[model samples]
Target: MIELSRRALVAGAAGATVTGLLATTMTSPAAAQDAATPAGPAASPIPGAYRYKVGEARVTAISDGVRTFPMPQGFVRNASGEAVNDALAAAFLPPDQISIPFTVLLIETGRRRLLVDTGNGPGQGPVGLLAPTLAAIGVAPESIDQVVISHFHGDHINGLLTAEGTPAFPNARVFVPEAEWSFWMDDGEASRAPDRLKGNFQNVRRVFKPLDGKVERYAWNKEIAPGLVSVGTPGHTPGHTSFELGSGADALFIQSDITNIPALFVANPSWQVMLDMDGVKAAEVRRRTYDRLVADRMNVAGYHFPFPGAAHLAREGEGYRYVPVMWNPVP
Candidate 1:
């Protein structure tokens, strides 16, 4: 028999260990690759909606889908396309692309069910989806007791009427901010407005006309209903409104279009989006409001934020950061 030294034995064992490890390592990646892949067909995303509670109240964030398009010139009136693209890149969003999302909120206070915003519906293409999303959550349009519109923007008020031009929420009392109503309803303002803005005035008339002075006008800081208070956050429009919901110790701010697609505005608060009727005023409101929200660690929901737009704000540098609420399957 050949004489085997202790060193040779150790070397042989080491070699065996190396070979085993190599074999395992060589197959591990492929095995992991196979495991990482989804089995069968790729699963598609379902209708967007999330539920949470405030005291005894129930709130749902409903999506009307999103409209994506190439970043256009003057998308950000204050910032150049290059700067806007840079912000998009930093956020890991595809550069030079824009996505405008619509959110319709549902608030239930035991006896009353209130909808904060009526999203773009079948009436508006390239966007509308709120109807089906609400249905997905078992809320029929007729079940809504009140519809509190945040502004006169088409995205916020379009769903007020169904595809057939009838009141979607037949039994609901539609409440719009009084200031918004005064400005948009003014024929002088409509005529003096730029050609591009004429469409908005026309759309507003188209949506609110069927109601025929029936739409209830609400004032700033006033309670529209129990636990729901209108917060005037103008600049996007003369009468743009947000809302605050408080129940027990829980409170939430429904930030309707305060800053569209936070990747740009919230990340750079001074940068103004083209949608703001008064960019300067909008930026000021954004900074001041966000500062307050950050200081209080307040919860917020944005109409133009990503689907399920509820989030918290953090003061980052001169701007703010949007921290999306964690997905909770169990309310």
Candidate 2:
């Protein structure tokens, strides 16, 4: 063997280190395969449905999915776009877009099943998932005993019919507020309705015309079903209504579109959504309803709230804060 210079010895060591790294990399077959292959498509979402109890009544919250779109210029009639963006940001929601969720409630007491406000009917983009969601939870449309509507809004009444424009709930007795029936079913009102609302008037006819002789009109302050009383909370529409369900000592307030996306209207009661037919009256109704809810410590279920939207209200600053009720895994 010949004596080596220090430079030659250093080069040999460096070469050895490179060889070791190469051998390690070559040995990792699994890693190489993982790096070579792209990830598979994401799994489908679980069926969106939840069940909980309100006293003896079993209430099921069925999600109709969400609609996300760029925020309209006049989304908030009373506030500027910049202010609306700020409010959205404060709620940890992304700016420049609005995501409105639709939730439908099904209350079962004794042998009767009453569905409150059908969601957007089938075939409407991300919406109209109510039928499938209900099916997933084993609730057949025919099993529904009564379908009590909160208002005449399309999202609230569209699901009354099927994709083929037939009654979805073939065996259910459909109930509409007397006031709502009077407003939307009036020929004078239909003729005089603004350009924007003309479509709503037409849609109301489309939905109710099929159930004409069969529709049952119920008045405010009446018991539409067992342990359920209708409460008129208008302004969002001329005849918008809410419901109070009481059993024993427990109660729940079904606030239907009283405040769309509580993150905005609930936090700022004075701010009005463009959907409000009477913006001023809607604001006033919102504040009044919220005050009573806070005072009574009532549990509330909202139609336009996120999935499984059940919460309690607390007065925060000038507005109110919605404290979501904890999810009960078992009913």
Candidate 3:
């Protein structure tokens, strides 16, 4: 039995509280001048947090930021670099460069604050903003009730611990797919893994070792909270999962890293990206998932999609197209 920790990092958790000087010095003459200073030369604020509703549940897309790298050969293992470049150009993206963004979901079910995935935790460059974004949205890191991980990938599970290697969400129960845990936690499995995969195996052990007796392993077809249902959409990882949010008569599918940058994979379903652990299985799942999304005309969310990564999938010609949901002022 997992003896989960009940400890919490409690402070200013009753309601969203601004921690900086602005709240206290708003009336000060100095504050007025500071506000007029324009902070610095014109620059756009970092965009991350967003909110919407799935029935009575309040859902948010908290961004962890992005990693932009020069397009490497075999970025799409099955497709040629030239073909990928063409697709990028068609999507109006710069050629020879790829940017992967990370967006985690927050589902507030009136009673429970459930986070779908934790982004790259602190120390990761250009990422690790999940904690701050939660703060901005009035949710203290300690206030999260439970964290349901899609799989054990670094970007998804690294945020589970702090810089010192302790559970970041002290009081929250960490739920992971049982299948993922079994494979990665096995000593024999890691020993036989290829050199390139040794790091991934090591990282998973590093993250969950301390919480061995505490992590809750869940199975597929289970309701994570209330209307949030876990769907087994593996392949990227042996146990990678996606979710379906059903409320009232409405529904939203949470597609977790099933496909990265839809402009590439979603538009060309047959073209496989580099990270599809089981490329064939990944492509199979991708096609099946998108088919349902198109038939249902469902609103969906993707972790690697642009910030607030909520969109609708459509069957274009050979592959499919993603239409982003228009931003709404109210949740």
The candidate maximizing lDDT is 2
The true-versus-predicted C-alpha distance at residue 79 of model 3, in Å, is 0.7
Candidate 2 residue pairs in backbone clash: none
Query: Global CA lDDT of candidate 2, please?
Result: 0.78
Best by TM-score: 3
Could you give candidate 3's per-residue lDDT for residues 97-167 as a string of tens digits? 99998988888787788889898987776778777556544577778889999998999999999889988
Per-residue alpha-carbon lDDT of candidate 2 for residues 1-331, written as tens digits (9 for 90 to 100): 0001101000011112211111111111111112234323312132256666777887877777678899988999989998888988998999989998888889999999989999899888777877865653456888999999999999999999998889999999999999889999899999898999999999998998787667999999999899999999999998899999988788899999999988889999999999999999999999999899898988899987766778888999999997887643521
Cα lDDT for residue 31, candidate 1: 17
Model 3 ranges with Cα > 4 A deviation: 1-46
Question: How many pairs in model 2 have backbone atoms within 3 A of each other, for residues 3 or more apart or on separate chains, i.e. clashes?
Answer: 0
lDDT of 1 by residue, 287-318 (tens): 98999899888889898888667788998888
Off by over 4 Å in 1: 1-47, 123-126
- TM-score of each predicted structure versus truth: 0.85, 0.86, 0.87
Give, for candidate 3, the lowest lDDT window spanning 10 residues. Answer: 1-10
Cα RMSD, each candidate:
15.9, 17.5, 7.7
Error of 2 at 311 (Å): 0.6
